[model samples]
Target: MIIEGTVLRGPEFDPVEGRVVVEDGAITAIEEESVDSSDIVVPAFVNAHTHIGDSIAKEAGAGLSLDELVAPPDGLKHRLLRAASREEKVEAMRRSIRMMERTGTASFLEFREGGVEGVYALREAAEGLDVDPVILGRETVEAMEAADGFGASGARDGEFSRERNATAREGKIFGIHAGERDPTDINPALDLDPDFLVHVVHPEPLHLDRIEDSEIPVAVCPRSNLVTGVGVPPIRDLHERTTVALGTDNVMLNSPSMFREMEFAAKLADVSARDVLAMATRNGAQIAGLDCGVLAEGRPGKLLVLDGDSDNLAGAQDVVRAVVRRAGAGDVSDVVL
Candidate 1:
């Protein structure tokens, strides 16, 4: 397969007029030359954190507190999920996955609820889709064993040493939520030595030091935090300390669009557009252990091509800036997953 466009090449996403050659799904080479296409080729986005099961309940609990909206068991999000039938849930999830496909997301790291069955349900949702999902089963060790990893709700919610240990023993990853509402639970979550953490929106000085020392990768969902009344994450600080990726969080709270996530992240942080683009791509892939986030040789051929001449993106002096802060679903021309 040969894809021709202005390829965003390598980790820094340098714009190169070239054609990407893919052999057996792996990028073999990038031949730099003038191409006759006004397409912007970028690495397919990797959304590092998501609770896609909440797709059945989009915009359901408006004006609710953070805890009231998503704090496990009897929370409104869980209540809505419990009320929905398996078929309804699966269909809703499928629609969200389809939307992600149209917006140029190649993969996502899903923090799934409903145990082992939930993992299988998400798989069913993605049966014929090109966009793949890495499901992390919540609440049980068996669920973790059944899925790619375990996703704990938070450190304050419960102790997760058993699940964490089991995941490590089985060579699977374990991720937990921490410091979304406050700084208190950050220590405990960090102590679990999780593979990654989600929503560290309130990291204190000690927590920052710990994050730097442990080299933990944090997946930040700033828009979700803002919507739920929790403060936004320190994206630039976290990015400087460790690997930081962008996520859209619950579909109930926000749309599962990497474009929106990248836009918010780029505008919210003082970081460059290139770094924000990496957060929406390679950094997330690093957190999830995927090799398809960079458009480089010896990587997977997953790519997103947008029409540079589209009304929304035309006349931009900087391609990366346009993609990070301005581009939308309408600008996408093809998703070469």
Candidate 2:
């Protein structure tokens, strides 16, 4: 496969007029030359954190507090999920997955609920789709064993050493939520030595030091925090300390669109457009141990092709900034997954 366009090349996303050669789904080479196409080629997005199981509950609990909306077992989202039939849940999840694929997301790290069955349900929903899901099963060790990893609710919820140890023993990933509502649980969550953490919106000074020392990667979901009335995460600080990735947490709270996530992240943080784009793509891929986020030699040929001449993106002086802060799903011409 040969994809021609203005390729966003390498980690820096340098714009190069080129044609990318793909062999057996891996990028073989990028031949820089003038191409007669007004398409913008970029790495397909990797959403670092998501609770796609809540797809059935989109916009259900408006104006609810953070805990009232999604604080586990008794939250409104849980209630809605419990009320919905398994078939309904599966169908909803499938639609979300398809939307992701159409909008140029190649993969996502899903913090799936409903145990082992939840993992299998998501698999069923994604049956023939190109979008890959790195599912972290919640609730039980068996669920983690059945999926790619374990996703704990938070350190304040329970003692996760057993589950964390079990995941480590099985060579699977272990992740947890921390510092979303406050700084109290950050220490305990960090204590588990998780592979990654989600929603560190309130990391204190000592917590930041610990995170830096541990070198644990963090996946920030700023939109979800804002939706739930929690403060926005210290994205700039987190990025400076560790490998910070971006996620659009909870389909109920926000649309699962990387374009929207990137736009919000770019505007919310003082980081550069290139840095924000990397967080939405490569950093998340690194967190999930995927290798398709950067458009470089030997990497997977997962790419997003956008129409640079589209009404929304035309006349932009900076391609990276336009993609990060202005481009939308309508600008997408093709998703070469």
User: Tens digits of per-residue lDDT for model 2 on 1-337?
Assistant: 9889899999999999988888998999999999998899999999999989899988888889988988889999989988988999999999999999999899999989999888999999999999999999999999999999999999889989999999999998899999999998999999999999999999999999999999999999988888888899999999899999999999998999999999999999999999999999999999899998899999999999999999999998999999999999999998889
Which runs of model 1 end up more than 4 angstroms from their true locations? Answer: none
Q: Cα lDDT of model 2 overall? A: 0.93
Candidate 1 residue lDDT tens string, 138-172: 98999998999999999899999999999999998
Off by over 4 Å in 2: none
Clashing pairs in 1: none
Q: Candidate 2 — worst ten consecutive residues by lDDT sum? A: 63-72
The alpha-carbon root-mean-square deviation between model 1 and the true structure, to one decimal in Å, is 0.8
Write out the backbone clash pairs for model 2. Answer: none
TM-scores, all candidates, are 0.99, 0.99
RMSD of each: 0.8, 0.7
